[model samples]
Target: MATLDHILRPLPLLFIIFVISSLHVLPASATSSDKLKTATTIRKVNRKGPYVGLVTVIETEEDAFLASVEFRPDPNHPFIDLSGRRFRIGKIHGKKVMYVRCGRGMVNAAAATQQMIDVFDVKGIVHFGIAGNINNSMSIGDVSIPNQITNAGLWDWLNPDKAEGSDNEAYLDIGNYNVPQSDGNNNMLGSLRYGHEQLYSVNGHISSPQNVFWINTTQEWLHLAADLEKMELLQCVNASLCLPEKPKLVVGLKAATANIFVDNAVYRDFLYDTFEVSSSDMESSAVAMTCVSNGYPVIVIRGLSDLAGAQTGTNAIRKFGSLAAANTARAVLEFIKKLPSNYNVNS
Candidate 1:
């Protein structure tokens, strides 16, 4: 309720306020977004970083590294918290590294990856965790290192198929508030929907929508990981429970990501036949996208913890998740050991 004269009576105070505002003490909103991108490739990121980042989606996933790898926490800077994630800086397997748990879901995964690249000297990223199996041929406890990852969460739930028998790639005909009956299968049974997250990098500062379906991983890392196909994986979850056969490593398959936990057999089969993906997880695609945008090398190692929605009887994820994570950890360790000391994490 002060008049202009009264408000301006404190001339020195107003001058100080003006000075502080003029100095721009508060950071601009774009400051953080500006940091979203850096080098676009491992070669550009530099050879100086001893760290090859290890990213996980959950605590159990991080346990995979904790069980097998010897992590020497960074002596000077042991940990960093950014975007609600604590990045543990360390050296594993005698190689410099920073490990961080990205938590679950696509947003957390993407944020963690961006923070890891922007906040540290991250040369490459190796994301490992457990996932639902899409390929029935592959059993629980086996690991899959796919060549590509994609986000299937982007969607357009269309107006119901008003014109019946429309040749849509996916159309669940549920008309007029109808509760479509399940054909003993958890089919989509609803309106048609589209998916595939959009983003094609025109450059570091710009990404345009391209409607692309896949995010390819670093070819160099994928070829190197190919050797792991022969490595043995953990088969037994203790004495009583064991996988039917020795868990195997299968490489070069495609994997997918979505916020949704896929557990419907009908949708699972649809994903399998449509996308040709071998595994589905909640995080990998976001990590892959972030890495790709930053021009860094990235690969995801996933343990098959459940058969997506196709598992018979009870879902085994709760029982075998740790086992799968451990196998993936072993695979990551082997991959690290195989890297030449001179590789410099792609410096």
Candidate 2:
């Protein structure tokens, strides 16, 4: 003899209990005396800002060709469209994503990266693509994520005269030398923050440092040795100052390092045996440094495409480049999806 409202009120709770009981639900016995709640609650999803930008630099049609193959149109994202220049710019995976075709070299890469941050108002940026392997232990398909960066050519000694002189040579020195915002002695205090890490270093090579290396095992390569090599590192780092709130940045995922060019491998054995590098390519160091200086989380993923040693006649670069680029792209997309809501300064 309960009222209809009272009967329905209990019905919902009763049904829930019935369903749980029928399903043989029971909490795991973690300890001897722990009590279990009647129902397990689902945690709410804390969605963050969608990753808004991804940048890649290609020197040739072939380089861009690799990117095009991996970038498929998202069915749910009908608004996504490539600009006339072939850069993908639109909603991707429900985020207002923009892909800019940053041209090759340090300068081009810098310009493109700056525009994406400035015009698009992107909250985050991922600069991806290929790199040449510089470590002998690394194979053609192995990837490199360099946490350090060194501008091999940027460490020569500064003449004291130039600092105090008044000639055009003095002015030229002043114009060219950007005394990195570092404590003169590699002090960690003035270092830039990236994630939980601190990044501090300047460009230029007045003298060769001990560990740096180029294609050849020489003092010069060692002096200018950098974590990665792209044309845009300094420019991108400098540009961050202009943003209202600088975007979080990272570099590289699918790349290889080669002591020699992909087209030639005459000294493959020597390169594999002596030269510390394994694969070969064009960009990455520039991008890596930019991310580090600007306080962004970075992950470098890459795929190996060739063996620089005796097994040299393989067209693995083409076959493996595509696979690596695709795999790298997928990984990057997954990372973007799970970004925490409070990832940047603004958040």
Candidate 3:
């Protein structure tokens, strides 16, 4: 037999050389295959369009149903399903429209809106659904067209004693504090970024620099809402469920968006008094922000389904959610019909 070192040294060197060659060959080949597969998948699923987008929150399936009913889907051009999210192309009022149901809450709304813009070439967005009424003057089934939407929970929570100013304006003082940033997730607070900016103005007046992230609807869209406001809204969902008051469209009001489902009278009062918002919802402001970022116009039409915490008994959402959704759908369809055939979102 050969001496141990002499026999094993050449074999070990050869083994190392073989392993290095395999690593280079295998990984390079695998990476190339992966790239090819990715390219093929993108080619298969990518959609091209000059389409208008409509978004509805999942909590209000009635809204999505009503919107889908207005559109006549083309069998030859079926909706492209990306993963589980479906994007349907259809004709509404003779206009090419894409309908998607964005799940409830701020993050879901933002992600869905951006997807429509990036993947579907969505020119503009119209979001419809139900909201909780903060204004006592409004009733169930009434529609609110918000000119401005602010994130309600984007704030620095401070002790009442630490806050400066009168009790009515005490929240403004907390704006000075550099609180850890959060993405509305309780556990992930302070992980992503830091500090807050003055992103909201109460009725166009900026009182505090923290606690609000406001996004204004485009003027063109608001003008369209003004015209739609003139149209009569549906007052009943069915024979068994008629609104106590005739549903009316109220435009130019403010709305608040948050992840919380607010059913407390005290919080409702705080939001209404602080923001002068007529309605509160879980999605609209985030949708507004996405549209704004894309340089696209967006309008939010919310039908009141509850009094938000004013009632002591069962929530009105159970009773009037369908009616509110129908009214919102009606308003959105009417708005689409009124759009000029040559309306260019770019202009």
Candidate 4:
């Protein structure tokens, strides 16, 4: 009886300890909440300033540009571990720059631009890649530096009944109903939300509000691009092949951005006629909006790989995509060389 009593006395102490441990344990929901809080704190603390941002849309475009410059792995870069994405620190004409492939759409572009602004000290952004030509005058491989960029997908979908008194009997309007009033900072301080119910029949997922607009490229950058001497652009993909004509650089044109990959001639004409856009792409406008929000001046240089369905034969992107990418990279590198090191955004 005495030995049994001794064992039961230790059992009560052990049970008490177990109860205390359970009391200290966090609930699963609370643990998840704490993890989210920790991640948010990390992102806020990782904010960085005062660097040039270079972005491309895909691996091929990124590879083409990287081939032009000697870059090395930035060991201390936080985003280096991300798979299937390219991030490097490189010099173009002796200017230090951060190059990243922003993936291939409006969402990815916006996210990459925001990440650059949040994690790096980006004072200005220079985006370069290939685009579908909206203008018939432009030929394949010609480079276009757009002065203005607009989100072509953001629009007010009006019922036909509501369009009776409108100037044009159109069912769609240019401005979004949910767009916030400008905060007087060049109309760059607003948010864009996807109207999934109005625009699509899929699972209604509304995008978090983001900056979107007809943002203009930095005038200083545009001026620098205008003074650039035409460099020799790639005219052939291989030893036995060559393009019909040499490509020329065109600056100060308008560009439009959409979530859709536009390959239809009717839509191409609409974009040209409505917005006077010389080129159409998937990412530029989103990049511009993010730059505007972060007070980083931005510029876009795109090479024409296709005529946005104006061509009759095989798609130009399939044949001349590499050439277009190379030309844009060359033009951007030249512009970087000419840009003054002491140039200030406020000045």
Pairs in steric clash, model 4: 49-121, 50-121, 51-121
Per residue, candidate 1 scores C-alpha lDDT tens digits across 203-256 of: 544545555668888888888899999998888889998878899999899998
Per-model C-alpha lDDT, please?
A: 0.74, 0.38, 0.70, 0.69
TM-score of each: 0.77, 0.43, 0.73, 0.70
Off by over 4 Å in 4: 1-49, 70-79, 82-85, 164-213, 343-347
Candidate 2 ranges with C-alpha deviation above 4 Å: 1-51, 59-87, 91-96, 150-280, 291-299, 308-310, 342-347
Q: What does each candidate score in C-alpha RMSD?
A: 9.9, 21.5, 13.8, 14.6
Q: Please report the TM-score between candidate 2 and the true structure.
A: 0.43
Per-residue CA lDDT of model 4 for 62-141, tens digit only, reads 87887874443334443432224555654555555667898889999988777666545556889989999999888898
* Predicted structure with the largest lDDT when compared to the true one: 1
User: Any idea how many clashes model 3 has?
Assistant: 1
- Model 1 clash pairs are 40-295, 41-295, 46-347, 47-347, 263-309
**Cα RMSD of predicted structure 1:** 9.9
Q: Where does model 3 exceed 4 Å of error? A: 1-48, 62-64, 67-69, 159-212, 343-347
- TM for candidate 3 is 0.73
Worst 10 residues of 2 by lDDT: 37-46
The deviation in Å at residue 147 for candidate 1 is 1.0
Q: Quick one: ranking by lDDT, best first?
A: 1, 3, 4, 2
Clashing pairs in 3: 155-211
